[model samples]
Target chain A: MVDSGRAPRRGRPPVSDEQRGRQRLDISRHAVRLFAEQGVAATSGEQIARAAGVSERTLWRCFPTKESCVEPLLTKMLDAFRTVLHAWPPGVGLIEHLRTAYQPVLDSSSGEDVEAVLAVVRMTHDEPALRAAYLVLRERAEETFTEVLAERMGMPPATFEVRVQAATMNAVLKVAADEFARETVGRGITPEVLKDHREQLAHALGLVTRRLSGTDVG
Target chain B: MVDSGRAPRRGRPPVSDEQRGRQRLDISRHAVRLFAEQGVAATSGEQIARAAGVSERTLWRCFPTKESCVEPLLTKMLDAFRTVLHAWPPGVGLIEHLRTAYQPVLDSSSGEDVEAVLAVVRMTHDEPALRAAYLVLRERAEETFTEVLAERMGMPPATFEVRVQAATMNAVLKVAADEFARETVGRGITPEVLKDHREQLAHALGLVTRRLSGTDVG
Candidate 1:
């Protein structure tokens, strides 16, 4: 809604925050594709810039390091997560909220965006630098989970119990993300079968965290 | 004991496993310090090689990426955990084994080594590149935990229950490491009291994973 095609009346033909974010995401998407096609070490900032149709200096402006070219794409994977957490209703349970949010997030996301995200995450397993970028994002996501869980559980984020919950919850989500990524990383699963994997994730989360309820039979 | 000093008269210089492990640890220790002192972005392979007193080519031989230069030092932090797991006798609980293993691990680790590890981990909070490396190490640690938990729980490593245990257990450890690293990263903690932090880790592990017992009041 914020995109204005016209040249702005403001000084320096200003770039909006939304525009800047999109630009960076575009550049990162290109970088990830290049890194995946060849290899991260073999791919240079100049090549990424050329593929993205931007100046190398502009690429550096958006990303300080070459290894960080995947950060924006990694952040994309977590966009649904953060949004879901932020909008989580106070009365609803965590599992219920996750199940509710899953399909909508998938529906809203373009196939290409999800494809790029999974591609980048898959590369993290093989590429140390990209993996590092991916992990940094994971750590940030855990921090967000801690805050959200703390608020929901009526405890400080730093409380020992809360942190464990946050960590374990994130771990379950990670396992799901891993499964989804694995499907794409290999021969690529069809959307219909992929939906079954989503259900698998929901089931896994319930099983893993059911100990919290004391309801699951060992 | 296997660190023999005798030079090999064969095709390549014979380095004992212990000796090679130590050599890699030494190089990685130096690299982490360099990363800590200067940002990872600013640090160069040549600078790290000079600091470690190795040729640039030798540094490349030891580590494929500049980001991976810290891997050996990280592996050192987990060495105690792995060794303790390997020696975990049957009929012993997981918590009990950890408590028994904690002190000896700390005692065997050199002050300099621990300092380097904490330094890098702390940097992870602020440095994206280093954070990635730390996360990569954390992932491998999870795999190892999965194997150990599989044996202890009498299940396959890939079992859902086994993985949840592995992930949760690693999360607890990460909290302890985070606390310990926090102390070292800032004002540094006393070694005697630092010993207490190890116990805190043991206690936290018990509390976090106790739910696995099917007995939580919550």
Candidate 2:
């Protein structure tokens, strides 16, 4: 029963999914750095590939378009937010829970990561292509928020109230990000700046969700 | 010394901006009809032009792309919303003002116009290109809302609170429109349905903007 070629393992193991993700993240970091240094219009996939030490083919395989190179970082930020939101303690106000849980993540992120994320956010304010990518990612993330909020409130995901709640929460977060980006124009993200960012977010979230409770949103 | 072709002396009066807008709106209605009859993918620009009783060149001039043919209708909807919001009476609660001032517009809209608008909104739920166009129009409209809300709240347009308020307001309206579209599936918009739509919008707006006041958002 010689099935070596048909069903047996190859000599070299395939790259793990985690390894591929890491490679994509690394490429995204390089692409973002180039975009920040130059501009999105002037940056090219070939330049990003060269900077990331990957072939152009590999870079294309990782991203469908040049503008999408920022998706990895944007998705990472959203994933962190979703993680914090999903782990929110029951019976505690969402604003208070977010203040306690989400603030530390912002405080503890590597300065370089924060800078890159902020730079991408700020660039989105002016770059239409980058703004499109950021918005697409945000819209996709909002679907998950709809599901989570619906479950928390014992309502269907398609209910208008649940849908709007999710949309409003994301809208508040997006505006807060834009504000943070604006604040970082000349000044970098310092402890004081980050704290201000956190408080601004909390204040906005409090205003938005003050009426969203399990029993009485409508 | 007449400049002849370079100067005045046009035989026929130029198409007024209002006439051009009417032409675009007419072309858009035809395009939407074709899209509703056939899927967006199956509908062609030439087909839309034929249905619209115009040259393909005219249709192309009217819309940058086939997907954007829906923009005129979406923009009209946003413009109407802005008109209502701008005319909202002061010293009255927003929800109450919207109910008194905005609900009549919805109730009085011609049935055909409401049907076409609902069809386009419902189609956006399935078509990504149309959704992009819809989102682009909404984002542009939000900028004006930002200005209006900031002025009403006595804050800078770029302030985080005002920006988020504008965004949340648009998000609520968008979700309410989506709900209205969903309700129209297999049935037409009725008085009761439209009333429910108005209440849902007011409720969602109340939830998002309960704390947005002239002096105390922060």
Candidate 3:
């Protein structure tokens, strides 16, 4: 007999990895809606599962705890940024690369995705567990920026100037994104507003990188 | 009957405000020691009060919750930065002001104060509540930097450039401080090393500020 915990044997079709990831994200989206509507404390695993039209057992299997349900959504946002950086071409300046790659993603992402991001932001204000998760993701994002920056600068990520520039650049992006999220929550987000925010961030980070590198690429 | 909640009459000897603040800090120091020696979850309010040599009532009066015990120490460190910013001269640039103000504080702070700072840093790694406290302190620090940058640029603090500069500068200082704290814990903190770290942070922030401001300060 095949173990229930393990994947189905060769006789039956197995669940695709992409399908599983999507399902997890679907659950997270529903969980966030429930959290935003009611308080986190008032929401439960069963409620989240029902909202997503899944069994409680499946919800538990997907997320060990309710607090972790937000991870998939948060990770999506970070992953989008990483994808932008990864596709950045050589010899292209930082601002130009960010604008070209990042703009496309912002344009393609739907209104619901933006709402999910806002939910995560609002949750971070009161939920300590969620806040920790968000901060850890940010720390990892900074490290990712450091690696990309080092590659661009022809220096080790551990070098002082590279690390400093990475930190400053990371800070500028974060502050700009946070400000955008805050504004989005207060006044519904629009394409023009997001474009403006991205431009400002790219410009600010570009300025910092130029100064730290002591070069005039612009 | 007199109200027990109210302060003593004017004729009676009054507890000096400085003495009261010190008392709160003393409680926080002990609370941190208890948290470090034993895990936060394992430690209780009664134990913290006992460790602090204060009655439970007094502990409750000072702090609304057990997690808040770290606030006093965290506030002290943040206040130190604010104090330096407040005293900054008009003609001085960011690096020069930081170097001058930071060196004296480092030289004057007692070893115990340094230990307390380290405790807060260590707590931030695992404790969600403490991490929130630390982040809030960082937010305040960013605002303080914004004000300073605005003053230096002869602009209002509400300007976008000032806010972005403040955010970048705050991020640099935070990364540098976290690095220093981790190194201090792993090896040991010495006067020379502390001075070097301060200078590096000042230089990093100065470069970023100059770039953002389009100034030729360096």
Q: Could you say which candidate leads in lDDT?
A: 2
Error of 3 at A2 (Å): 27
- The window of 10 residues in a row where model 1 chain B has the poorest summed lDDT is B209-218
- Model 2 error, position B9 (Å): 12
* Model 2 per-residue lDDT tens digits across residues A33-98: 999999998998899999999999999999977878998877787777788888876667777777
Model 3 lDDT, residue A177, Cα: 69
- lDDT by residue (A46-154, candidate 1, tens digit) is 9999999999999999998887888777776776777777777766555666666766236437777778778777777787677666766777788888897777767
Indicate which candidate wins on DockQ.
2
- The per-prediction tally of clashing pairs is 1, 0, 0
Model 2 compared with the native: what TM-score? 0.82
Q: What TM-score, to 2 decimals, does candidate 1 have?
A: 0.82
Candidate 2 local lDDT, B85-141, one digit each (tens): 888666667787777677633643556766787899888878866776677667888
DockQ of each: 0.42, 0.57, 0.40
> For model 1, what is the C-alpha lDDT against the true structure?
0.74
Model 2 misplaced stretches (Cα beyond 4 Å) = A1-16, A43-65, A104-109, A212-218, B1-16, B41-65, B104-110, B212-218
Residue by residue across A184-213, what tens digits does model 3's lDDT show? 776777787878888887877766665433
